[model samples]
Target: MAQKSIRYNYFLNIFRIGFGILAGLFTMPYINRVIGVEGLGKVEYVNSIIAYFVLFSALGIPMYGIRETANRRDNLKEKSKLVIELLSILFVTSLVSYLIIFFVIINIHSLLDLKPLIVIMSSTIFFSNIGIEWFYQGIEDQRYITIRFIIVRIISLILLFLLVKEPKDYLNYGIIVVLSSVGGNIFNILYLKKHLSFKGFTIKDLNFKRHLKPILTIFVASISVSIYVQLDVLMLGSLKGSTSVGYYVMANKLIRFTIIFIVTLGSVLLPRLSYLISNDKEQYVVYVKKSLNYFLIIAFPFTVIFLTLAEDFTLLLGGQEFLPSIITMKILSPIIIIVSIAYFIGYLILYPQGKENIYTIAVIISAIISVIANFFLIPILGHIGAAIIAVSSELVGVLIMILLYYKELSKLELISVNILYYIIASFIMFLTIFFISYFNIDPLVNIVISSILGFLSFFLFLFIMKEEIFLSIVLDLKSRLNQN
Candidate 1:
């Protein structure tokens, strides 16, 4: 039953992430065509500006909430109290963040034109509190999250096509962007009634005092992390203009999209790992090992494929006019593995163990590196420079985290023979795809064929090398077939 539940969480997130990426890939070119490069850039620019506010509104509640809620899931009253208190805190903080946003928009001379879109985008802050995404995540009841986000995204996608018909419909497109996230948040609020009663809970029951310090600590860490993240788009928009922002956004989007497959595992596993740490160290160790192995098996190939087929991927996803993103995507591709490693180290380990200070230090230093690098590079290389800084900074942060937590991390013995198998598989797959693509064909067709052939070769190499993940999947399939 436990295994089944864990698999359920993993696969639902897989469905949501997979669906979101596939849907975006299908719709992006059309959306870009309608919006125009500059228009798309403007949209990305505004969204990037709003992301900081969104981050501030979020603070550390999501992570902190997940841990606290998961620990208290059995006691309905305690869980309810945590939810209300966290929501109250979230509400107050989001309002404060929104006020800051309002002030910035009004005071900044360049942002006046985007005042409307910025306001509309800011609606997400309000929804962020009501969403209580942490509550559901804590319980590992991701079916609701999966269904809600997937349904909302699909609706937004349809609305995007129907309403956003031209470049002038940038505002309409902006509405779709807000709907993508906020729509589900509304559902999350409505869903809360089924689980807990707000009417019975008073403000007196909410304990905001206890959570304040840790939450703020995580918030500062979040801000530092967001610095490097949103800095790319913000700098591009400010220094290089909207067209450059557009190209950079596309590349960043592609990298993020590809990362879903890798990161989703670590994300869904966090709560379980936290629980297992005290009660089941053996399982926890196994999960850590498996996460690392799966990250290599899963993330490595996607990065390699992106690196090798950057041009083809850009043309397929962004159209010919935005081919400048090809280089950015290539430069950013390898970060996939790095990001997975960072999450495994920072989130799965240090975070669950209450090492937020060390985590914060690592990310803050990383953000500083990003800022300095961007100052030097964005002016000279533009968006490509942003890509380089983002990747390099993450690498630095991961290294710092490893160094700080050397005693704990070293015991895990993350290096293994499976890693060599993954590398061998990925290398062989890359060669196969490279040779096949030499035929000179349609970009889309080339991508499709290369991915299929490359993945097949990857699987073949894994099987030959007896990779654990591949063997486990094969065995699981056999078990299911026999049961059927």
Candidate 2:
């Protein structure tokens, strides 16, 4: 029954992520028109810088706390204790982050133009700490968090469409985004109290120092991960400038949201996987292989879309000025597969089992390679260079995970023939999309047609293959719903 509830919540969270993406999809074209390339680029550049401080404030607590809390969910007192302890650490690190941000703004010569937005965006660090989403996630209570996402995002979406009307309102757009994050996190506090109360809990309950070792280990791993996530944008902003950042971020605005739907499956499964690691190893292995197969099902087709409709997508979403993003999207599309598998290895398989060092090593080496590649590439190729390095770095990370976890993979039965099925399915979809593109119609109509045909092809292929993992999920979900 417990596992069934988690699965149902996972489905709900999937819808939440999908709807949130759709809302952003609705908002993006309008915002891109109002902000234009340079204005949007400037907003992204500052947010990229602020992303560092956000990581600092978060300090790996989200993952660490989730694992720790999930492991101790039976002990309400202990779960509450962990939340308080983690939040206390988040407060200190957030303060440090703010101090550092202030120092950076004062001393940095290049960031003067972005200073005000930098300060404005950095507010996420503080508000996000109060949000303590880690607290909600740790206890495996996704209901309210998903609800919070819908309410706040819809509100932000309304505010965005209503207020952001011109290029001059770029800062206003930034404010809306930042405040939405802050407000959402603030709302997290209310939902958190309902799940894990701290009525008798006091400072004495928190072993802040005890958490630092594990939390900081995860924090370092997170910093390494941030290399691919945030550093690429910062490097582009620094070496290539805001217009380049704008084009790259425009791809990110679409691609990252697409990634979210698949990735949240991993997020929803992590705590459950953690629970399985200690109590149900067989279940753990079964879940791992199935989830990964599901990812390949989704990732393959999305990569094809990016490659086939790159031009149409760029023209429609970002307007003609961002045609450069067409190439960037194509360069970066392979990451769809690379990141999904890598995330499975790093987060679902390793972190839940307390294999932080291996995970950290993989991310760190990838981060180092990313830094080297960006330094060498960003100056010459700009966003194109950044995109190439991002994809390559992710590929390298996935390879390292595969190599390092080969024995584990064999034990988990990770090698499945279903991979070939997924490829065949995706290839069929790609061929359909490729054929649809030859019509030479309007880009908008082309995207709509290609997407519909491509999705239908993928679905048909999955059905034809009788894909076991995909079908089991569908059947189980239906069975569970019917029982309810």
Candidate 3:
């Protein structure tokens, strides 16, 4: 299969990411009013529970599959066999996960009420195996993946609005959520023929054992990472009930929404980076450096914007019911930079370099600290505690990775002096937005205006300072226009 240019894939991913988030953002205010905090919290808590099942069923295969598939992209026969082998393993794992969840829901008296919601959401685990999105990522075929995601998400959004009309309709919301995920997978399964052929791969040709060790290593890392990420919601729900989960997840989802942009920027590099590690180490380092610089430029501004306008964002996006999330959002905003760095270090660098062990260790240690902290903190401090722990744990994980890879990191010079320009520009933008927020304007109008002016000032400053990355991008665009 022929691969598209990195720029092409990146834009497609960005369009899909932007569209999906915008759709959710468009619907959230209505949903928040209709469902209310407690109702949303109930759905979030149930979804978080089902997320664990999905994570286990996945078994790190998604991450592993991306690298393995990219490695074999030039060899269709090998790629087919590898994909089949991974899918076979995924099938058993998802089936087992479903059975286990079924037992938990049926046998636990407290969960009896949520059984229907849980059952609906749990189908996501099974369909996840069929989706094989990792396969698409590995081949760097963002066009198909992006289109399928946007279509399914759009359909789900329409269904959400149509079906979920009241607080009592949270179950309907849950069903739509499942359909969103499962629907995408249905397309994915059908679209496999574009790149992969199942022929000539007998059962005997499949080699699960060859892939087992690396898959398991990444699986362990994935589990640790999920525990670190998801445990907060679980603990918050358990200790403070669904209302608190709603507040926390509201804040979290906003941060994650911004993070999708940052993640997408670097994620397109993974298959290429995986390929480059063996074929061209020098080029790999160059991409990593450029990506890190771009991450900081994007992340710092996002962090500052959220930190400055948390109230406006919270009020606008989630409405008055989500006021508590304002502070939570502020606490979690810095993770934009932290996670961008961690993603660059872990997925782009460590996994591609065959250092899943190091990646695993960092997150495992962080997860341990998170679990311990969450236990002590959630009961007393509630969602605020969870937010604090989330930031700290991610920071710790990033520090560990940097510490472990200091020698190599020093060579790459991941931190650029240009980041200073980004910081100054962000501070200026922050002031611009902060000043705007003081005016007695409508929340929605104020935010729209503040965001425009803030980002405008940010770029104006970057242009004045002649930031290298910004200038480079400008010159590249100019060149492209001239060519056209």
- TM, every model: 0.97, 0.96, 0.97
RMSD of 3: 1.3
RMSD score of candidate 2 (Å) = 1.9
Return the clash pairs for model 2, or none: none
TM-score, cand. 2 = 0.96
Q: Which is better, 1 or 3, measured by TM-score? A: 3
lDDT per residue (tens digit) for residues 163-250 in model 1: 9999999988888888886757888877786776556677777778999898888888888888988899999999999999999988
Candidate 3, position 265, lDDT: 68
Query: Candidate 2: misplaced stretches above 4 Å?
Result: 1-4, 199-202, 473-484
What tens-digit string does per-residue lDDT give for candidate 2 at 1-484?
1334666777788888888778877778888888998999889888887888888789889889778888888877888888777877777888889899989889988888788888788888888888877656766667777788888888898889788999989988999989766678877776666667777777766777888788889989999989888898988878888899988988876788767778887888888888899999988887888778877888888998888998988888889889889889988888888889888889889998888878888889999999998999999999899899988888888888778877877778777778988888888998999888778999889988999989889877777788787787778879989999
Best by TM-score: 3
In the predicted model 3, the residue pairs found to clash are: none
Model 3 alpha-carbon drift over 4 Å, by segment = 482-484
Error of 2 at 15 (Å): 0.8
| TM-score-sorted candidate list, best first | 3, 1, 2
Residue 382 CA displacement from its true place in model 2, Å: 1.1
Please name the candidate that would achieve the greatest lDDT relative to the true structure: 3
lDDT of 3 by residue, 1-484 (tens): 6779877886797788788778878887888889889888888888889888888888889889888888999998999888888898989998899889978987889788888888888878878889898898999988888878887888888898899999999999888878875667878888888888888767877778988899889988988888878999999988999989999988898889888888876778999999999999889888888888788878988898789888887888788778999899999999999999899899999999999899999999999999999999999989999999999999999999999989987987777678888889988998999888778798889878988899899988999988888898889889999999
lDDT of each: 0.85, 0.83, 0.87
